[model samples]
Target: MDIAVTLEGLGQGFIYVVIGILFIWLVKKIDDWRTRDFDDDVHIDDGNIAVGLRRSGLYLGVAIALSGALGGSSKGFFLDLSHLLIDGFIITLFMFSSRFINDFIMLGNINNDQECVKSFVQPDGRKVVGNTAVGMVEAGMYVATGFILNGSISGSGGTFVQSIVSAILFFILGQLALLIVGFLYELITPFNVKNEIKSNNLAAGIGLGGILIALGIILMSSISGPFTGWANDLTSFGIYAVYGILMLLIFRIVIDKLLLPTTDIATEVKEDRNVAALIVVVSAINAVAIIIAFSM
Candidate 1:
């Protein structure tokens, strides 16, 4: 039994490593594409491929360790990890794939001189990134919830159906919260607004935000349901949705009233307050979701 479990861990670890490598490759390709100018003559440095590999390896190691820790928690842990990895990987691939579509659909018509439009790409891109990240996280939660509902690690049709419904509902609510905060941020934060407007680096910032969103989703999803189950079992905690919403509202007010007021936006134009707000709110929501998921 011990040998089988160890072999399973190794197998799962290899799978995660492979998925991480693919993401690394996609990130590199996007970086290269973004840096290339309209003039094919412009030289582009791909940057340290070795360094990239090393960083990805580090992340992979962390993920593997996390998986091991989770698996050791119970018989259901391995099954949950499998679901999380599969769903997370699938959603991430889809999210990145959509970037290509967006690049073509949104920016296909502009001439080389108009390449400054790349900056516009970020504001929009961040939304996609944020949305995708949330989706992935929700997927992970549903996977765990499914196990809980069925009282087993093996997937079930009834549990899966309910989980899918729950995930969709939760995802929509999450996105709505993110979008509202993003809009508010645009209105209040001079720094965020200026960066959104006249800044020429929108797409780059959006890419970063999107990646972070994905990371947040993965982290949150991995533990919310089980944590909630544990908490409920121990303390009968409840009201998770309300707690998440309240946390978001509090954070939104703080960012809008305090941080935005400090920024001097007198000189900046057309800043994307929405994206900025979205960042703070999504981050808060992600954090709170984990808390509630575990607590209830």
Candidate 2:
């Protein structure tokens, strides 16, 4: 390998790093706008540390994931600046749009006031409380969205229009996966997920969030690679669906038997706000994600 070519690749990677930083800043602005009413005070307080950290993690994770995906398609480890900027813009658009979809699913229609925003407020006009559950759920959603977007564009050797269309298709597929996960959660749990999160049930929120991330990871493998046609895609989806279900079942059994033999996870999570149980579940989900990501 030529040293000059290697250096050029490194230089392009640095450019991506700079783009990631700028995108994170843009996300912060959007977050502020979304939660403006909650944090209306001019004086910034320290009450939202957890929320801030979660949001920061989300932005950075997405930026890195997307940049890495773009890097995979670059020529000889070097991306053209113009192409990098354009791809970055497209990714940023998809990221924000995905977040909007997540918000709508988790919190309902915010514009119609049929949401949970009011629950975060206090009579004194200060929303000082940081709901870690909601933050965790949102963070998981961001990771899921990033993975789906990344997988969609991972080896897409296509024109700009084709890439955009592929991204849109994968995004819709990702949303459908999320809906299925949500439905599964509802079937397994007795309590309502939105109500639990709105009431600050950290355990319930984390448990549901873990499932979302896990599904994203499982589907990521299926989404990557060349799109031969609709028939091939459908066949791939069927095979991956079986694999995902089996893997989830194994993880669930392992966590219950090995990780927490003395505890009933679902009951503990629903009734007691058991943070430890929730953490174990999230860890199990993420461990599977890591394994699958590496294998792919």
Candidate 3:
């Protein structure tokens, strides 16, 4: 590669990082507004560091993913500055919308609740304040939405109208996939996920959140290339949906039967707040996601 091209790429990457930081700050402000009573600056008292960190992670991950997509689609290492900034803005809007959707699913409203800021009792009897578990789930949703949108935007290579339609279709498909995953999670557990997370069950939150991110990673692999037409697009989505279901089944079998044969993973999460077990489950799902991401 030309030295100038390399320098330009690095410069654009730095710009993305700066924009991402600013975006995170705006997200924090919006979160504070939505939550209404929490103060992010005071970490020791009413502040939920875990929530903040998780949100930051999601923002940063999405920024990086979007940047990578832009880099890949560019003619060389360097991105068109106009396109970079434009797409960055678009992605930022998508992230905000995605957050709203997550809140709708998890909180049942666009506004945050005290339940999300409630404290939980750990296995060691420590009183941990803030619903970090909910944060985990939110993070997963944000990251997944980012990946899906990023892939969709990158894949759109036609006229503006066509691209818009394709992006919308892909986004809808991604949301449906998330819903199916959530349903499957509910089936595996005997308790209500929202209630469990609202009760400050970190284990349950992390387990559920990890599965969402893992599913998103797998779904990202399937989102590539321009849409041929509605028929082809629907057919491709159906195939990916089947693949996602199969992957979920395999994930369940591996976690429940192969990895933790002696442990009832769902029961552990629902009843015991087994953070360690949740970690193991999350790790397993992420391992599969990594393998799938790399293979693609």
Candidate 4:
């Protein structure tokens, strides 16, 4: 390899890592400030499972979005750096917007952060902490949004304006897709998912949250890559989104049969609160999504 090319690649790689760390750090500060009333870091230090889970999702999600923003086709170091900063800011705003979306749209009845933030004491010197179930859902939403955001800005061979416009449109579609996924999930499942989650059913929350992330992985493939003509790209994304959703739905049933042949997933999740069983469901969903993403 040429010395200049090798050194330039090394420099780019180094800056990316540094920038990625800095973004994560900056977002954490912003997040902590945004919800100072809850103080996730403080509670996390105190072993608050809900805060821990919530924070975990946000961190991972931010990283995912950053990777997509900075790792795509490069126009040069300066251009890439400019895009990184711009996209990072946009992503930060979207991160907060995602919380609002999760609060109002995904689980309208539940104040998700409220559930994750507050704790209470019991009669016999016991503490009933914040709801891990709600935390899981919140976490899942962030993680899913991370993947969606990644796809939104990952396209290349286009102007910055084009990329921004594409991201905005694709992100809107992603939000809609997520909502549809939630609706379809509730529609097909035997028990009422929202009610189950409200009741602190960890299994139910895990199942829903895990599926959301899986769907995001599948969607990223459809939305990412070099941009072609507007009409062609839009059509491709629409077809892929529908196809991915349908396949996920089908896989839900398939996993139930093949992975958990003996266990009734609904009963386990709703009645027994079997988190282990739901974990199996999550793993299988993610596995299938990754397969579909790569196979395309």
Candidate maximizing TM-score? 4
C-alpha TM-score for every candidate = 0.41, 0.81, 0.83, 0.93
Query: Positional deviation of 186 in candidate 2, in angstroms?
Result: 1.8
Total clashing pairs for each candidate: 12, 0, 0, 0
- In terms of TM-score, how similar is model 4 to the real structure? 0.93
Instruction: Write model 3 residue lDDT over 1-296, tens digit each, in one string.
Output: 79998897688778767766675666567656765566655653556755674556556656644653464455443434555555555666666666666777644632334444566686678887667777777777777777776667666556545655665677778877887887777776667877777767778778777877787777766776665777886787668766765686577667776777777876787778888888887888888776866675
* Model with the higher lDDT, candidate 1 or 3: 3
What is the lDDT for 185 in model 2? 62
Q: How far is candidate 2 from the true structure (C-alpha RMSD, Å)?
A: 4.1
TM-score of predicted model 1? 0.41
- Model 3 residue 169 CA deviation in Å: 3.0
lDDT of 3 at 104: 79
Q: After superposition, how far is residue 122 of candidate 4 from its true place, in Å?
A: 11
| Model 1, span 26-138: residue lDDT tens | 54465456545432112112332222322232233234323322332333645755665554443333333333322342223322223321223344563111122222222
lDDT of 4 by residue, 1-296 (tens): 69999998998889988888888888899888878777687778888887788788988988998889976667888888989989988887887788788889888789876777566553245676777778898888899888988987988888899989888888788878988898998999998999887766778889888988988898888888998978988898788888888998889989998988888889888767888999988899999999999887
Candidate No. with top lDDT = 4
Ranked by lDDT from best down, the candidates are: 4, 3, 2, 1
Instruction: Estimate candidate 2's alpha-carbon lDDT, on a 0 to 1 scale.
Output: 0.65
Say which prediction, candidate 2 or candidate 4, comes out ahead on TM-score. 4
lDDT of candidate 2 over 1-296, digit per residue (tens): 99998897688778777877777777677667866765522222554533653575468547745753564544543344565566666677766676676667654532211132323553346564555566667767777777777777674556656656777787787777776666666665666777776666668767877877787777777877776765676577657755775576557657766777777776777677788877877788778866865675
Candidate 4 or 2, higher lDDT: 4
